[model samples]
Target chain A: MAKQKEEKLHKIRKVTPGSVINYTLITLIALICLYPFLNVVAYSFSGYNAVLSNKVTFFPIDFTVSAYKEILGKASIWLSMRTTIIVTLVGTALSLTLTTVAAYVLSRPNLPGKRIMSTFMLFTMYVTGGMIPTFLVVKGVGLYDSLASLFLPVAVSVYNFIVMRTFIMGLPFDLEEAAKIDGASEMQILIKIIIPLSLPIIATIGLFYAVNYWNDYFNALIYIITPEKFTLQLRLRNLLFAGELNSAGANAEGIGTQVMTQSLKMATVVVSTVPILLVYPWLQKYFVKGVMAGSVKG
Target chain B: MKQTDDKNKAALRRTTWKQIRKCKWLYIMMIPVLAYFVVFRYAPIGGIVIAFKNYNVFKGIWASPWCGFATFQKIFANKNFWNAVRNTLTLNLLNLAVSFPITIIISLMLNEVLHLRFKKVTQSILYLPHFISWVVVAGIATNLFTQQGGTINNILNAMGHDSVPFLSDNGWWIFTYIICNVWKEVGWGTIIYLAALTGVDETLYEAAYLDGATKFQRLIYITLPSIKPVIVTMLILSISSMMSIGLDAPLLLGNSKVQDVSNVISTYTYQLGIQQAQYSESTAIGLFQSAINIIILLAADRIAKAMGEHGII
Candidate 1:
């Protein structure tokens, strides 16, 4: 009994220094990751004068929602927001459907040309024809300048396909065999039996697809030429790169100009990121799961 | 004997057709996918022929006059092209050297955490940055790194130090680029390593503990050796695509002040092909990048296989 207590005490002592160092480092990194976003939030909510005086830090200085108000009132922001919503919704649905169908088909053991089909998809992951050729193909297909251009050309990600396929392949063969014995067709089996069991993966992959579409600016930048058709990221990029975020009728005096512009830019950042941030916590657990699933095949 | 071989070939082909016919539903399901691959992927592959031609909108791809290495010659002659190549290589190498090991180290540290709640919370927060768009990352970076009354600069001035031109100076801009890249990705990169670490046997650790191995010794002996395969795989995968850098980071983080340091292959191709209408030269540059990528990928896969690691390919 004395020896047991002594060993326990020794184990506890050994853990202290390592745990302290690990916690300290992890906490510091977490703070570093969270600080920039917090800074943006603080700047966006700070009073114009406080921001102008460069006093905003971890907390908002002289808090106000006027920056968000001014931003929300803008027609261009609303237009871009609407465009982004449409693209994300449509893009996610299309990508999920195509990816699921492809993955399911490819996952079948007795499916003809399964190896060749898998290789066909996998080959693209390594050697893409670079940017311009893909651009030309998108143009040739009449998707240019449309919302379809944002998602259609890149609908079925090979990585996502592989991940989803791996998930499906792990399901017991007897489940499908039983369904097949009952005269359920492949489509019916997929919709009724396979999908019901695979909701976790579907939800996870759906979130992946949604995030990809939501955050994509490269597609919108390269394809969408019109200002009004810009997605949220593209619009945010324009606002940022243009460097003119001054409110139309607000105070245009002295240092207030830079402060207002900077605050407004920060507010735009807040606005653009809010959608992803809102859905983030709910989908976060699934993201870790998805990463694991993907990495197994990877 | 020749006739028998021919008969066997015909019989094999018939069986193949019969199997394909039996799996007609699967083939039907694959229609959209195959079309997507053909049009979006393989078609672009065929579009590489334009690199050899002076691509003209009116003449189209086939009607355009083939230039016979002229585009490659032009790209080689251009100083900006060389500069872009150098910058891409330097930035990628820097990223590989710094961010790669940091990812493994962070994962190891996280794995060592005694409290589950602390581990989960840190992971949640760390993964947050990866989901944020590059535009937002750039915007936030600008807010922090700008010389005039920027957050970092303001803090520096308050501490009696001169302001740093993080966005304006070429070298500092590269530093800022790396910081942003590492900051955005480091946590997310840990996920793969963490996943690999989970596969490590718990029994080994218990045995080590029983053998009077210190925590650090166990980590050095058992933990490090176990995760080495994953590390090697990830390293090879990264090394295989050394020439390819995503356009978003460089383009969004860059300004005219640091163009020399920031212009990577993707951004350079974008500017040349889209903005300047130098399509043939851009295509040629892209083709060159693709060729180098394939060579590296094959060589890396071969080396990995030769080293008795499972082939990544």
Candidate 2:
């Protein structure tokens, strides 16, 4: 087995010109992908006056930590950040649990009412009842203006469920058979065998759910009335639309309109994005692989 | 034999009950999801009746008196409604025309590169813009295209040229919106195409190479045909979402100066429903948008089937 593994490694090391070109292109594309993010980071740290003067570009010209300090000093920013973190964590947990069970049940090849249920799920994807109806539904359920409103309404993503079902379906049946032969129940088989092997896809889906919850402003914009319940994205939108930089201790009069707003906008963008961006690199390989895997089956 | 048959039937029933009992954990697991969709998806669907009712706050949806087709009639009579429809269709079509081909080309270019690390880097860079929210992108765009001391104006002034109001101009609004959207989304869009490209048989590419087919020719014959199914599937998907041009971009970028061109069904509905509290009329318009989207999706799916492609049915 060791010799065979070594031989496989040796074969993989046989590089071709095509492979070299592929590496180069991917690297260049990755840099291009990272550039705008880098530009935002640069602009966010650059002095407000310097950034407004258009002195900052790919790199910060007059780097200052004041913008960071200014934003951090705000009590509301921290509150919103805490709210977003709570929402994202709770939402992802709920989404994952429900999505997994529902997907697993739906994925059972001979499960009763499988076709009917699948069609029902698919119907929701294609034909939603629209915003007002959905809002009414939320209100009807007594989830209005609550944290439960944020997580409960968006618990099952049909797309993620589909991806998960596809992944679960692709798992080897031999393992389940072995568990059954050992007198283990179907539930035990899933818990002990299927879940352990399904971690990559589960994690990938969880990340996707987390990002969705984190980036979600529309729900907060519509459902949330209290300022205390605001997510990061909603707060950013409020800042941009309301132009309330004067309240943040920035001398709005001294700073040019474009520079202050743009820089502060950049700051908001950075703050809202950094947490997700930080988590992405760790899961990116799984994410890309999961996406490809999911697409292939579909 | 009769006794054995009776025993088997009893066992089957017992097993079914046993299975249900055994999977109680799974049922528990599904509760949150079930509750969520019930409240959000199923419940909101019930709210569709508001379109046909007066929908007074005190009376609420159930208690409100039905006013059949009045909201629809009002929506039809409103000039802004028609303008929004026209703008949405035009912008979506333009986005389809421009962004679709560019995504394919970029994917092809990325595929052609032999160096894995370089290709990965490029992909990462390209995908970065997708992560930035539309609100920030709109901010960047306005900064670049603003009339005074903006980047575009500064560049134009250097050439002794006049700077045009790109954002506010009706003719330019659609173009600007499309460009910014493509810039943000195109890289992410390439992901599906790239996955499809991987499925192309290696032998076909080798055969083409042996036949002295150039890279470009190989791409035309081997690569394009390989990913055609994905393209068709995505096109169908895009057509499904054609009416939903997303409220965020158009709302953020739009102002009173350029409302005519930038307004879409979603933003208009939000304006009526949320901002103005014209609940019944907005719901009617919302229903109209949903109907249009469904029609287009069904039509597109039919076209895909006619073209011998598997479509989302």
Candidate 3:
């Protein structure tokens, strides 16, 4: 009993001087990752004079929401937000459906041509036809200038498919076999037995697709010309790079002039990132699992 | 002999058909995905022919007049193309140099933490930036790094130092770029290493502890060796795609003054193909890049296998 207690005490580890330094460095690194964001929030909420004077750092000085009020009051921001939400929802649905069906179909043990199909899919991962060719094809197929151009052309990520396949293939063989023996078709088996158990992976992959669609500015930048149809990221890019924020601020309820462009820009950024921040904590654990599964590389 | 071969072919065909028939529903389900691959992935491969032709919007891929190596010749001679290639190499190398070692080290640090709550909170904060869009990141970056009334520069000025120009200056721009990338991806990169670290046997550490080994010694003796395969694999993967870089960071972070330093192949291709409408030349550049990528990947795979490491291929 004494020996076991000693072993347990030893297992708990001693708080050495080295460990104190280690914890300090680790905490410092985490703080470095966080401070820039804290600065942004500080800027977004700070009064115009405080931000212009460069006093906002860790927290809002002279806290005010005029920037947010000016930004939220704008129609352009709302339109782009709606556009992005639609694209995210529709794109996630399409990508999830296609990827789930593909992963399920390809995961079957005795499925004919499974190897060939998998090799076909994997081949695309190594060799892509380059951006110009992809653009040509997307435009040639009449998907240009449409919101579908953002997602349909790149709906099924092979990485997500492989990860989903690994998850499905890891399912208990007996459960699936028992279902098959009970006269369930492959479709029925997938719907009744597989999907219910595979919901975690499905949610992980769906979040991946949704995040991809949300962050996809390049596609919208290349494909869509109409400002009305612009995704939020695209609109945000325009607001940043278009250098129109000067005029944009001038017309925004007259507080635009009172609000610094820096605050306005940061406020827009904070709003656009809120959805991701909201969803991330809830789904953070799943992301680790998703990435680990992906790193297995099928 | 011919009759026997024919009979064997028929039998093989019949069995293949029987197997396929048994899984017809699976095949039916695969039709859309197969169609997607054919149209989006494979069909563009056929479009690579435009690299050798004078690509015209009205002429189309099939009707474009063949120009042989002329477009490739033009791309090869362009100083801008060479500059872009050099810039891409510089940025990618610098990025990997900072991110690679830091990722491994941070993984070790996280592994050493005894408090689960503290580790979890730190990790979640670190990973939060990965989910933020580049547009948002750039916005945040500008607010922090800009010279005129920017937060960092303002702090420097307050400290009685010269304010650094992070955006307009090429050297400083590259520094800013690396900082942004490292800040955003360092936490996420720890995931793969942490996963590898978890797979290391616990008893080795316990045994080492009983032998009076320090934590540092345990990490060096046991943890490092255990995660060496993953480390080797990551190095091979990163080295293989050294020629390719993303378009977002360079394009968004770049401006007119720093174009000399920031115009990588991807952004160059975007400019030439979409902005300038020099389709054939841009397509040739893409082909050249893809060719370089394949060659590098294959060579890396060969070197890895020859060195007795598990090759990424």
Report clash pairs, candidate 3: none
User: B1-313, model 2: which lDDT tens digit per residue?
Assistant: 9999999999998987787676666556556666666667876777888889888978988899999988888889999999988888878888999999989978888776655776676776676676666666766666556666455666777789997777767777777788788878999888888888888998787667667786679888988988898899888888788788788888777765567787788888887787777878887887888888889888999999998999877
Model 3, B38-120: lDDT tens per residue?
99999888888999998888978889899999999989999999999999999999999999999999999899888899999
Each candidate structure's TM-score, on Cα atoms with residue i matched to residue i, is 0.94, 0.88, 0.95
Superpose all Cα atoms of candidate 3 onto the true structure and report the RMSD in Å to 1 decimal. Answer: 3.4
Worst 10 residues of 2 chain A by lDDT: A245-254
* Candidate chain B TM-scores, in order: 0.95, 0.94, 0.96
Q: Best DockQ goes to which candidate?
A: 3
Error of 2 at A82 (Å): 0.7
Model 1 Cα lDDT, one tens digit per residue, B113-194: 7678988999999999999999899989988988877899999999999999998889999899999999999999999999
lDDT of 1 at B138: 90
Best by TM-score: 3
Q: Candidate 1 vs candidate 2: which has greater lDDT?
A: 1
Rank ordering of all candidates by TM-score, starting from the highest: 3, 1, 2
Global lDDT of model 1 = 0.87
Error of 2 at B12 (Å): 8.9
i-RMSD values for every candidate model: 4.9, 5.5, 4.6
- Runs in model 3 lying further than 4 Å from the true structure: A1-5, A243-260, B1-12
Native-referenced DockQ of model 3: 0.51
How many collisions between residues are there in candidate 2?
Answer: 47
Q: After superposition, how far is residue B152 of candidate 2 from its true place, in Å?
A: 4.1
List model 1 lDDT by residue over A1-298, tens digit each: 6775576557656757668878898999999999999999999999989987888878899989999999999999999999999989998998889888988898888776898988999989877777888888899889999989998888889888989988888888898999899998889988998888877788889988998899999999889999999999998887776542212232211224343377898999999999999998988877777777878753
